[model samples]
Target chain A: MTGPVLTVRDRGGQRVATLSLGGLARRAGIVGAALVVDLAVLSSAPGTPWWPGIVVLTLALVAAEVPDSQAPLLTLAVAAGWWLAAVPWPAPSPGRVLLVALALLVLHATTAVAAIGPPGRVAEARVVRAAAGRAALVGTGTTGIGALALAADGRVVVPGAVGVALLAVAGLAWAATRPTRQ
Target chain B: MSGWHPTHAHLRAVVAGFGLLVAGLVLGRVDAIVLATPLLLVALAGAQSRPSVVPVLEGPQGALAVHEGEDVVWSATISGLPAGGSVAALHPGQRWLEVEPETGQVVAADDGLATTSIGLRPTRWGWRTLGAPAVTGYDAWAAWRWVADRPQPLRLTVLPSTEQPDTTAPAPHPYGLVGQERAVRLGEGTELAKVRPFEPGDRLRRIHWPTSARTGTLHVTATHADEDAHVVLLLDAVNDVGSSGGLVGERSSMDLAVRAAAVLAEHFLRRGDRVGLRVFGDWRVSFLPSSSGRHQLRRLLNVLSVVEPGTARGEDALAARQGLGAGTLAILLSPLVEPASTQQVAMLTSAGIEVIVVDTLPAELVTGDRGRSPEEQLAWRLRMLQRRLERDRMASLGIPVVTWTGPHSIDKVLRDLARRSATPRLVRR
Candidate 1:
C-alpha cells in the first residue's frame, strides 16, 4: 500500500469544471433569463438606447452556447453593453444603475456555477445557495455605494485620492484571490 | 494541501469591478462606479475571507464488506473550512457502486468539517476494486475549491451467501479419524454396534449389566467408530452459458456452478469433513488439498470467487481426474456444455473415485429462443440433445447427474453412492 497522495492540481483556485450537455442547457437557460433582465433594465432606464440592450442580449445568448473556456468573454461583453447604454444616458437614477449591475452579477455568477464541476452534474443546493448568498451581499453593498453616490448627486469628486485608493483596493483584491504556490 | 487561489469567477468579478471603477472615474460617470462597487466589494470580501487553513479530507470509509443487496456507506469529511463552510462532492469509481440520489453532494458542518456518505452495493461475488473517490471541496462562496490530495483506493471482497442444504447424506467413505460420520469399524462411540461376551481384557465399564444378568456371564457393548470423509469439489469452469444479471437476475451457468460448489463446501466442512477444491477451465487451474476447519472454508470460497469460464481441451479433463484423492467423493459442478467434462466424469467414476455431477446449465438455454433465429435455435436444441446423451452415458458408468436446485440438490445421489460403497468394488491402479 502507498501513502496517501493528492492527484488533483489546484490551478486557478477553482473547482474542476465539468461541461455536461445537461449543464450546458441549464446554463443556456440562466443566460436567457439574464438577458430578459437586461432588456427590462434597459427599457426601464430613462432615455437609454435599445440597440445596446439588443447587442448585449444577442452576445450573451451566443456566449451561452460557447465552451466554458470562452464563455467568460460573453459575460464581459454583456457587462460592457450595459455600461455603454448607461454611459450615453443623461445621468440615470442610482436605482436603475444598481438594477443593471445586479443583473450582470447574476449572469456572471450563474455562468460560474454552471461552468464548474464535471459535466452532467448539477450544482449542489448548498453550493448554489452559498453562492447566491455571496452575490446578494455584494448586490447589497453595490446598492449602498450607489445610494451614497446618489445622495452626493454623483459629485463627490476627489480625483487623485480616489484613483490611488481604488488602485490600492484593486491590488489587495488581486492579492487575496491569487493562487498561492505551495 | 495547496494554498488558496482565486477562481475564474473571482477573477472575472475583479476585472469587471476594476474596469468599471477606472472607466467611471475617467469618464466622470458616477453610474458606472455605482454599477462597479458591488462587483468589487464582493470580490474583495471573497478574497479577504480566503480560508485560513486548507480543509483536510478524512475518509471514504464505512462497511468495507457487505452482503449482496446490502448497502455500504462510503464517506469523507472536510475540516477547517471558513465560516461560509464548504461543499464536498464524492465520485465513486465503479459504475455498479450506485450513489444514492445519483448526486454526490454534501455540505460542510458548522465546525468547518463536512462528511459525505455514498451508498454502494456489490452485485456479484469476488474481490472488486471500489476505486478512490475524487473529493472536491468548495469554499463558502464557491469562489475557490480545495481538492483532497491523493485519496487511497479501496477494495471490497464479497463472500458468496452460503445457503445450507436441507438434506443430509452418508459419506461414501470415511478416513479412520474422529469425526461426525460413523465408520464400519467397532470402537468406543455413541452409536451401538454390538453386544458380545466380555473377554478378560474388557474394562469393567464396558460390561452390559442386563445382558450379563440374563446370560450369567459378563458382556461388553461395542459401538461403531466415528470418522471424517474427504470431499473433493471438482468445478468445471470450461464454459458459461446464458447471461448473468448479477445476484438478482437469471444466473448464468458459471454462477450456478460456483454457488452450488460453495454450498457443498460449507456443508461438508461443517460436518467435520476435509473438503478440497479443484477448478479446471481455459483460464488458470486452481487446486486446494483437502483440509477441515473454518479457515479452509474461507480458502475454498476465495478460490471459487475467482473462477471464470475457460476453453476446455481434452487434456483438462484428464488433469482434473488426476487431481482427485483416493477414496474421496468427488463432486463435479459443471454446465456440461463441453464433452471434455463428461469424459472426465466417466473417468473419475470408473476409477472408483465416487463421482457425482451437479448439472449447472440453466434450463432456459435449451428452451428459450432469446432472440435466436430458427436455424440457431435448432442447432442449440441439437447440442442440448447431445449433452443429454453424454449425461446418460455418464449415468451408465455409475456417475449420477443431478441439477442444482439450492438445498437437497445432491442428497439423493450422495445417498445412492453411499449405499453402493457398502459393496466391494475394484479400484483401477
Candidate 2:
C-alpha cells in the first residue's frame, strides 16, 4: 500500500558505488581536459604562479577519481587552490579570472555526476547532460558580469554605507540558499 | 523515513564560497570576490529552488504472487516531486530476488508527478519476504535527498512450477458419487457392464431391442458407475540433504519432495480425484482430509510453501500414518532419510491403503558426500545401503518405489500398480 522509500543504507552490504576502469578513464579524461583549460587561462595572466594551477589540477583529478563521499573535500581543495592562485597583489585580469571560474565549475559538475550513485554504477546520460547544461548557463552569466566590470572606467568606491549594503545583500543570498531540513 | 538533509555536494559549494568571500574581504582582494561570486550564486539558486512539499511515494507494488523465474514490475509513483528531475534507486533485500537495471531516473511532469519501475524476478519457490527496498529521492542538482518511510515489508509468494505428469494412475478404489473412474458395481455409465432381463424398476431407455428379440424376453443394458478416488500424498520433511540453490541451483531433498508432491497433487486433482496431504517433521504432523476442486489444490500448495525440514521424530511418522483413510492411494514422497519413515510406509501398505513410495532423494547426495571425512563417508555409505535394503523390502511386499524424473517419472510404477489392483487381495480386519 505504501510507496517505496529511498534509504541511504545499503541492504545486504552491497557495494553501491563502483568505478570501472573504463569509467575511471572517462572521468580522468574530463578532469584532464578541464585542467588544461584552467592552466591555459591562468598562465595568460601576467603574474599568475605555476604552483596554484598545478594544485588545482591535482585536486580536480582526485575529485573526479574518488567516491562521492570524498569528492566534496577535493572540490573544496580545488576552490582553495583557485584562491591561492589569485593571492598576488596585482590580481589577474577580469577575463582570465572569469575563465578560471568557468573551468572550476565544469570540474565540480562533472565530478558530482560521476560519483553520485552506488559504487561502479555509471550515471545516467540525462543526469550528466542536465548538470553540464546548468553549469554552462551560470558560466555564461558570470562571463557577461565580468566583462561589464572590466568595461567600467574608474574603480568603484566602497563607501561604508555601500559596504554595509553589499554585506546585507550577501547575507540575504546566504540565507535564501541555506538548505531546509524536514 | 529520514528527513531532508543537505548532500555533500551542496555543503561543499556553500562552505567554499563563503570561505573565499570572507578571505577576500579580509585580505583586500577584488579578484577573489569576483571568483567567489559565481559559486555563491549557484549555491543560492539551488537552495532557493528547494520545494516545500516532499514527494509522497505510492508503490513498489505489483504482482505479489508469481511462478519461479517469472518477472514482476515493482514501481513507485511520486506525486509531489518538484518539476525538474530526480533519481530513484531500488535496492533488493535478498539475492534470490533479482532486480533488472537496479536504479532509475525520473523527470517530473508539469503536474509534478513521476513514476519509476524496476523489474524483479524471484528465483525460488516459497513465501519469501521481499525486503523493503529503500527508495531515496535526489534533487536535480543532487543537493538534497529525502527518504520515505514505508510501514510494512513487501511479501512475495512464489509458487512452484507444476511439472506436467505424462502418465495416469488407475484408481485403486473409487467410492464417490460421480467421477472419471470406472466402478466395480454396475449402475449407469457409458461403458457397458452386461445385458440382463429387464427388472420392474429398469427404465425403458436402457432396453436393447435386438437382445430382447433374440432372447425372447425383455432385456436391458447395464453399465458401471463412475466414482472418484481419494489420493493421499505423504510428504517426509524429517531432514533436508544436499544444498538448494533456489530454482537455478541444485535441488535439495526437500525441494524435490515438494515439487513432486505438487505435480502429483495437480494431476490427480484435475482427474476428479479427492486429494489429501500429510506432512511429518520436527513439528507436529499436519494433515488435510481428501477433498476435490481447484481450491483444494491451492490449499495443498499453500501448505507446501510453508514446509521446512525439521528434526525427525518416530512418533510423528506414526501419527502421520494414522491420518491415512482406508482404500486411498497413499503416495509416500520422501528421501527415506529416517528409518521411521520406512517403517511408516511398511505400516501403510500392510493396512491395505495401497501405497506408492516416490524416492525424492537427489542422486547427487551419494557423490556429494565427498566433502566429509573418510569415516563420515563410510557412515553415509552404510546408511545409504540400509536405505537400499528398506526399498528392496518394500518392493518385495508389492509396493512400487519410483524415482522422480519429471514428465513420465511415475508412469511405469502407476501402470504396474494398476495391474496389481485388478487382482483380489486380502484385507486386514
Candidate 3:
C-alpha cells in the first residue's frame, strides 16, 4: 500500500531506509494470503452476492498493509460472517468448510507474520516456514474435527451434551494459554 | 523486557474461534463448528509455544573506527529465544551514513541465535553515532511478543579521506638538517657547489686536485645542505559553506578544506617533512606541532577529523595565535568566505612565513545555481566580488592562491614560490 519504497518506518518509529529483496517478498506473501482468503469465500458460496466478499477483500488488503492495527481482526470477522451468510446453512458440506477454514488459517498466519515486525521488515524464511507448518497442523486438526462432526450428525445419543463438552475443552485451552503477569 | 504478553493475532484467533463455536451451538450449524476448529487449534498451539524466558539481545556489532567511504557492518544479535521464536530488528538511518536495504528492517528465526545486520558505508568523515538497533522477540505463532531494552548507539571516528596529490615540488624554505630538499646554506653534502681555496677546518678529502694544481693552492668543494621543510596546515573552520552530499556527491566547503589539508599533510610527511596542523575557529584551538614520520601523519589526520566549523568564531584572537617557525611553509586551506580568514593569511605573510592559500570552496557554490531567488543571487554575486578583491589583495602581497583540483593541483604554485624564494625581496617583520 505504501508502494515499493527504498525505506519505511519500523514499529519503534525509526526510519528504516534500507531496501531489501526479502522484505518485498514478505509483503507479497501477505497480499497473496489475503487474495486467497477472498477467493475461497467467493468459491464457497456460488450464488450469493459478491459485494460482501469484495468488502471483506478490501478489509483484508488493509490488514495486510497494517497488520498491527485492528484491521486484521476485523477482516477475519467480516470474512467468516460472509461465509456463514452466503453458504446454505443446513446442507453445508465438510469439504467446503475445510476449504474456507484452510484459507482463513493462511490469512491469519500470514498477517501474524507481518505483525511480528515493522511494515518494512523482511520476515525470515524460516519464520514463515514455521508458521506454515503450524497452519498445516491446525488445518489437519480442523479437517478431523469436521469428519467427526459429520460422522456424529445423527448417531450421537445427546448432541447438545457433545457440543457442551467441546465448548468446555475450548474454554480450558484458552484459560491455560492466557499470559501470566510478573 | 517484561514477561511475554499476548499479541493481537492471538487475541484475534481466540475471539474468532470462540465466537464461531458459540454461534454454531446456537444455530445448530455443523459447518460453523467445523470452521471454529482451525481457529481454536491455532490459538491453542500459539499459547503452548509462547516463549517463557526473556530473550537476551546483544550488539550492534562492527568496527568503531573507519575512514570515509569505507564499508562496515552494523549488526545486533538476540540469544536465548525459544525454538521457532523469531527476532525483528530495526536500524534507523542517519545522515552521511548509507545503509544497504534502505529500509533497515530484518526478521530472523532463533536458530540458537539471530543476528540482524545492515551494511553501513559512511559518505563523509567525522565522529558519527550510528542509530541503535531496536530488537523485538516473537513466539513461533506470533502469539506472544517482547521487546529488548534499547542499547547504546554505536559511535565511530571516521578519519578524513586523504587524496594522494602527485606533487614532487620542493618546499620553498627547507630548514632542518635531515631531508630530501636541497637547502641554500653551504654544508657537507653530495652535490658540488664550487672549488675554492681551502680554508681552515676543511677536510683533506675535500681538496679538488685539478683546481688546486691550476690555482697553485689547496682547494675544497662545497655543496648545498640537504634539510627538511616544516609545513603547517592551517584549516579555516569558521563557516562550512554548502551542503555535503558525502564522498560521491557534492562536497561542502568544510569537506574540501579537511580533505585538502589531509592530502597536503600526508604528502609532506611522506617526503620526510615535519607536518603540523592548526584548526582556526575551533573552540579548543586544536594545534598539532610539526613532526615527521607516518605516526605524525596519523595524528594530523585524527586532529582534522574532529574539526567543527563555527566552534570558536568569537575567539578570533586565539585562532590567529598560530606559533609557526620562521621558515615554515603554512598551507592555509579555506573557502575564503569570511574576512577573518583573509586577515589570518595577511598576518602569517607579515610574520615572514611562506604561505600558500588553497581555495576549498566548491565550484557549484561559486557559480550560482538557478535554484536561488533574485535577491539571493545578487547577494551571492556581491560576496563573490568581495572574495575576488581579497584574493587580488593576497596576490599583490606575493602570496599564491590555487584551487584544489586533486593531484598536482598546487605543484605549479609551489614551483613558482620556490623560484620567488630564491630571489631577495623585502619581507614584513
Candidate 4:
C-alpha cells in the first residue's frame, strides 16, 4: 500500500471535469430570469441608481449556485421593493406592472426548479419545460389580477374590519396547511 | 403516513408572498399585491398537490457480478409519486468504481413511477460494496419533497478480466485418457506411430495393406494415445511489488500474477485439461484441486479475485499441502523480489514436477528511479541486481524463467519444456 498523497495525486491525474448539460440550462434560466427582472426594475424606476441593480444581479448569480437558499427570493423582493419606492407619483403604468409581475413569476419558477436537486444534478428537460409552462400560466393569471385591481381601485372600498378578518383567516389557513416535519 | 414535506421553495414563496401582500394592504400599494399574486398561486398549487402516499423504493437493479472494465448500470425503482413529480437518485462515489455524472446523481420525472440510474464501471477486480442510493421526490412545482428511505446496499463481485495468453503449446506431461494432447504410450487414436505386427484385439481398420503386402504378413498401424494434462498454477502472493494503476493503467506484480494465473487456468480448462491452483503467501495458502470444466474456471477466477499479499509464515503450511500430484506441470508466477517466492520455485522443481517460473515484475520498475532518494536509489539498484543474480541462478539450475508480456509470453518456454519432457530426470519421491 502507498501513502495517501500519492493516491490522491494519481486520482487527481485521472479525473476529468464533467459539466452536466441540464445543470447548465438551469443556471442559464436563473440568470435569464434575473436579467428580465432587473430590466423591469430599470424601466419602472428610471431615476433609481444603478448600484442596487448590480447588487441584485450579484445575488442572483449566488442564487444560481445555491438555488435552495433564500438569495433568489430575497433578491426578487429587493428588486420589487426598490421599484415601488424609487418611483414617484401615482405609480408606473399597468404595462410596467405587468412586465415586473411576469419577470418575478419566471424568477420564482426557475429558482424552484433549480432547487429540486443539487447544483450538479441534471434535471430532465421535459420537467423544466413543463415548469416554464406552469410559470406562464401563473403569469397570465397574475396579469388578469393586476388588470382587475387597476379597474376597481377608484370604484370600490372594503371596510377595515373585513380586510383584517380576511388577512387573519388567510394566515390561519396557511399555518394549518404547513407541512409537518418528520 | 404521508412522507411529503414542504420544501424551502414552498417556505420562501409563502414568506415572500405573504409579506408582500400584508405590506401592500397596509400601504395601499397596488404593485405589491400584483407582485405577490404569482408566488401565492404557486404556493397554493404546491400545497394542493402534496403527495398523499409514500413512494416505494426498491433495491438496486443491475448485474451483481461483472468482469472488470465492463460497464454496469445500477438503478432503483420508485413508485407512488404524484403525477408530474420528479425523483433524484444518488449513489455515492466508491474507490475503483467510476460513476457516470461523477456525482452519481440522476433525476427523472414520470406519471407515478420512475427509475433513476447511474453508470458504474469498476476499474479493478474484487468485491465492491456500493452505498445505498439516496432518493428524493419533488412535486410538480417543487414546493414539496419526500425523501425515501435508503434501500439495501449493492454488493458487486468484479471478476478478474481474462487476458488471453496466446499460447497453443501443449502441456509437457499428458496424464489423463481423454483430451487434446497426444500421450506417450500407444493406444486407440488418430496420429500414426508406426506399422507393427498384428496384435490381439487390433481392429480390422488398423490393417496396413502396403506394409502387409511388402512383409508378406499382417501388419497394423499404431497411434499415440490421446490424453489430457494436469496443469497446476502456483501463485506467489508473498509480496505485490510496484504500484497498480487499475485495469487500463500500469499493473503491479500482484496484478500481473493474478491475471496471468487466470489466463493460464482458462486456457488449460477450455482445452479439456485438468487445471488446479495453489495460492502461496495467503493466510492459509489457498489451494484448488485439479479439475476441468467451465465451473472449475469460474471457481479458479473467484479464488484469484480475493488473493491478498501474505507474509512468509505461510510457506511452510504451503509445503505441507499434499495435492501436487506426480506428472503435474506446475507454473509458478512471481516477481522473485522476496527470497520466499524463489524458495517456492525451488521446492516445486525439487519435487520432480515440471515447473515454469513466470516473472511478474513490471518492466519499468526494473530501471525507473521511482523518485527514490540517492541512498534508496542505490538500494533499489542493488535489489534489482540481486533479482537478476537470482534469475541467473534459477536458469543454471535447469529452471526456465520468463518475463510476462501479456499474450505469447510463455509459448517458447512451454515448447522447450515439451521437447525436454522425454528426457529422464531424478525424482526425490
Model 4 Cα lDDT, one tens digit per residue, A128-166: 678888888888899898888766665787668337736
Alpha-carbon deviation at B82 in model 4, angstroms: 0.6
Against the true structure, what is every candidate's RMSD?
A: 6.9, 5.2, 4.4, 4.7
Candidate 3 CAPRI grade: acceptable
Candidate 2 chain B weakest ten by summed lDDT: B101-110
Q: After superposition, how far is residue B218 of candidate 3 from its true place, in Å?
A: 10
Per-residue CA lDDT of model 2 for B138-235, tens digit only, reads: 66666666667762456788877677776656667887887777778897788899999999999999999999999899999999988888889998
Per-residue lDDT of candidate 1, residues B92-186 (tens digit): 54433555524354454566766767667776666677767767765665567676775776677766667888867877888748678888788
Interface DockQ per candidate: 0.30, 0.27, 0.48, 0.39
- lDDT for model 4 comes to 0.78
RMSD of 2: 5.2
Question: How large is the i-RMS for each model, in angstroms?
Answer: 3.1, 3.6, 2.4, 2.9
Candidate 4 lDDT by residue in tens digits, B1-429 = 347878878887777777777777877777777777888888778777776777888766443878889998877788887898888777776777787655445355677888888788888887768877777888888987888877777788888888777777988999797888888998977889998999898999999999899999999999998889999898888888887777988899988898888889888888889999988788744788889999999999888877778654445733623688668899989888777767777777778888899999999999876545898888888989999999999999889999998858888998899998999998776
Tens digit per residue, CA lDDT, model 1, A14-100:
234444444555566556656755665566665666676666666676555542444564566565646655546444445666666
Residue B149, candidate 3: Cα error in Å is 1.0
Each prediction's fraction of true contacts recovered: 0.39, 0.21, 0.53, 0.43
Name the docking class for model 4: acceptable
Q: Give me the runs in candidate 3 sitting further than 4 Å from their true place.
A: A1-49, A91-93, A147-182, B60-63, B105-111, B186-224, B314-321, B370-372
